[model samples]
Target: MQSDADGRLTPGGGTDALFWGSLFRDLDREGSFLQLQIRQIIVSAIENGRLPLGARMPSSRDLAAVLKVSRNTIVIAYEQLIDQNFLIARERTGYFVAGLPKHIGAAAREPGGATRDDGRWTSRFAHRPSTYRNIVKPLDWQAHPYPFIFGQFDPGLFPTNDWRESARAALSVPEINNWARDLIDGDDPALIEQLQLQVLPRRGIRARSDEIMITIGAQHALYLIAKLFITPTTRIGVEEPGYPDARNIFGLLTPNVVPLRVDSGGLVLGDEFENCSLVHVTASHQCPTAVVMPLARRHALLQAAQSHGIILIEDDYDGELMPEEGELPPLMSLDRGSSVLYVGSLSKALAPGLRLGYVVAPAPVIRELRALRRLMLRHPPLNNQRVAALFIGLGHYRSHLARVGSVLLERARILDRLLPQHLPHCTWSRGAGSTHYWVSCRPGTDTVKLAELARAQGVVIEPGDVFSIDEGSARHCFRLGFSSIRTERIEAGVERLGKVITQTG
Candidate 1:
């Protein structure tokens, strides 16, 4: 059959007859309308590679005109194709054929029509959904009101210009040897110097360059630690009402996870230490609660770890953002026995996009971590690390941090003042030095439902249940992130969130 310029066969050709026959067959078999038939046609075309990758499909109007069907039917057909991954739509451009899935062997399909030979021999991950988790919903800073996003750093305060200049300088360097290979152990001299001379002393941890190993970020660092320390039956202790991602990671790695209660003083360690070998805690500022670990408890934790020969993984995730005056000493610094493996990151201090973090471990542990780092992705991007080191070495990092601290401190104060006006029944505690505020809701409030209502109104807030290890407590509490949004939006976001709480209650 001779095809026209638009790839459609002429009326005299067999194309029209074939199309009509296929449509009739599909309609007779499924009793579906024209839209469903069109959908099946497009799907079959994609599957058979007749509509190749990146090839633009006919527009709804054009397809409807050609097929003598309603435009709405074509639109619905296109929508189904987009949803099924048979087609992709660019923002302004029209829809195009999406990439095809990999082909499997015939053995994968059984005579009974099952993908596997036997249902009893199914893959462990067969039942899991193949959809990506949406991290954040679309947020309207002004209209929707209450915003409680976690790990949000104030963008207005970051030294964007200085960082750009630093990055440019690092890129402009004539010699770029490290870029070719991964510095798994992160042996960049400048970065090591900054860690030893600048960061460690500031945090009261005394560590040499040989003890530090850089990773992609704190998440990666935590993952490597889990791989090294945890096994299926290994007992691990994590702080109660702690970072959810950390809990999830540990849970996936090991079966025996002990939930240590966290109070105003930080991790409440009792006789549980006898059964646990590895403990994870945010000593600088406990997440969700924002409580600083007191000196007595810090010493007690170090002592417990030392006496039991346990390894304490100190996650100082947001330690650098603490205010100058009242910041407590890191647990690693308090460890005179060298039992703590300190993990620090620049995600909150600088930006999460940076993906820069360092682990200060003992000499032996550093060797094992380096091997694992090599096995993972080799190392983090060398140029990025080099620039980060340069930024830190040139005093720009400290200046930027000072700027961030001042801005977030001011924002925190604003949140404290405005939250009461909108949410009078809700009570907020003063944070030691961080971007978030942990608020206690009214006696009978449901934080999850409140979060849902806030999302419906176009604001994204994290419910307290994700952080709490104990049940029933999260219903009355939720965390508010004040770092990312503008100062003007803070009051309004809180106001909207307050309305959701009031209505839900």
Candidate 2:
């Protein structure tokens, strides 16, 4: 037995003594939780044969020292791996890889790698997906000094102690008995109770447990809604400059993705939506633009939907983040005809790695979706659902929400002060509360090029081209998210952005 150091293994533990820590050395862990990153790395190694079958892995202590994470973090990752069957443990010996694929071809290379055989994937498609033109921000964005990327969770805002406590509570014998089982085609009833009472009521949207279903995240929720309502013959209405991912999802199922115009008041309610079978909207804080759709407009949009027999899927993503006084109630709250289906997520307001979201619709719609969900994922993780229930049950969710709103509001104020002082030439739309700013450059400026070049300077910005259904006409717009950047970095990042804007012009 080589039991001298932390890396030592028991005699005859396994075949190879592999220390594959360098494989994750250059990986990015920004905006994501540590355990997830480590889990993903180990899974990738197993699939790629870098960690072959029966190969002994480095001890948890040694790997923790190498990765600069806590030994407990490595242990947690290992436990999850063991749970998922990617690794196995001896009674006292260190862990070893459990599974190895029969073959690892060039096709099985790292994610997004383009091998020679990759181009033929288009042949199997019924309709090709839309060509997304936006820059995919790197995952380890925290490693960068300036991150203006949208949709990232601020690590500083995570309620670690509360979440850990919630996890501990969920793992208790009684609670474990409740959440550890398959829950086949069922959700954590406690989490639904929390959502109905604590979460939805504030937004003025109320629902029964039968009317809601948990999803992998808001993205999965949106995808399911699109599958339910959209088809090749159906006309779907989307905002001109809306959430790109939503647009792409709808486009995949329908040939008609109608791009309606978005102004200061949000998506224009007009004849565009009249003929649409379904419409996707971000009414609270419009994606990309950060504009709140007015209350009057909300009523009018509902009226229009009723007249046209349209189903409106309201993505109430940022409603919880707004200041309570002036915020408009969600359209779902205002719907008397049961025409509005609401989408809400813990991922955006809490943590993306949790991949937890929910949909509120008619009970019939929920029943159908639950059947479909059973065919897809069965249900979102029982543990995540239960822990989330406790987090809300203990009031940590509301407290965390208030703290995040305060910090984002502070960041918004700082961004407002800095943007004018540094980049006076550009115009922007700032909402009462939202994570991002929609920036419109000078008449002839190419924001796409500016964004591409700014990355080289360590300032990552999201170009606006992808937000629009029509990318050709959206070259001068871009977005800056303040959620991830420190208040002190706002000025310099915008100053550097200003210089790049000037350089591009």
Q: Which stretches of model 1 miss by more than 4 angstroms? A: 1-122, 126-146, 173-175, 182-186
lDDT tens per residue, model 1, 1-505: 3345765333333665455344435443334577877787776665665555566665777666556667998898889888988888888657777847535223223244635454465465533222311234344543444446756544567788888787877776452654545555456777778888887787888887778988888989999999988998889998877777677778777768888888888899888855698989888778778778888888988998899988999999878674746778888877889889999987667877788888999988988988888887777777887788778888998898787778777888887778778988887654477667778888777787777778887667767776766647666888777766777777777777778877877
Which ten-residue region of model 2 has the weakest summed lDDT?
A: 9-18
Query: What CA root-mean-square deviation does each model show from the true structure?
Result: 10.3, 6.1
Q: CA shift at 485, candidate 1, in angstroms?
A: 1.6
Compute the lDDT of residue 504 as modeled in candidate 2. Answer: 78
- Estimated TM-score for each candidate: 0.73, 0.81
**Predicted structure with the largest lDDT when compared to the true one:** 2
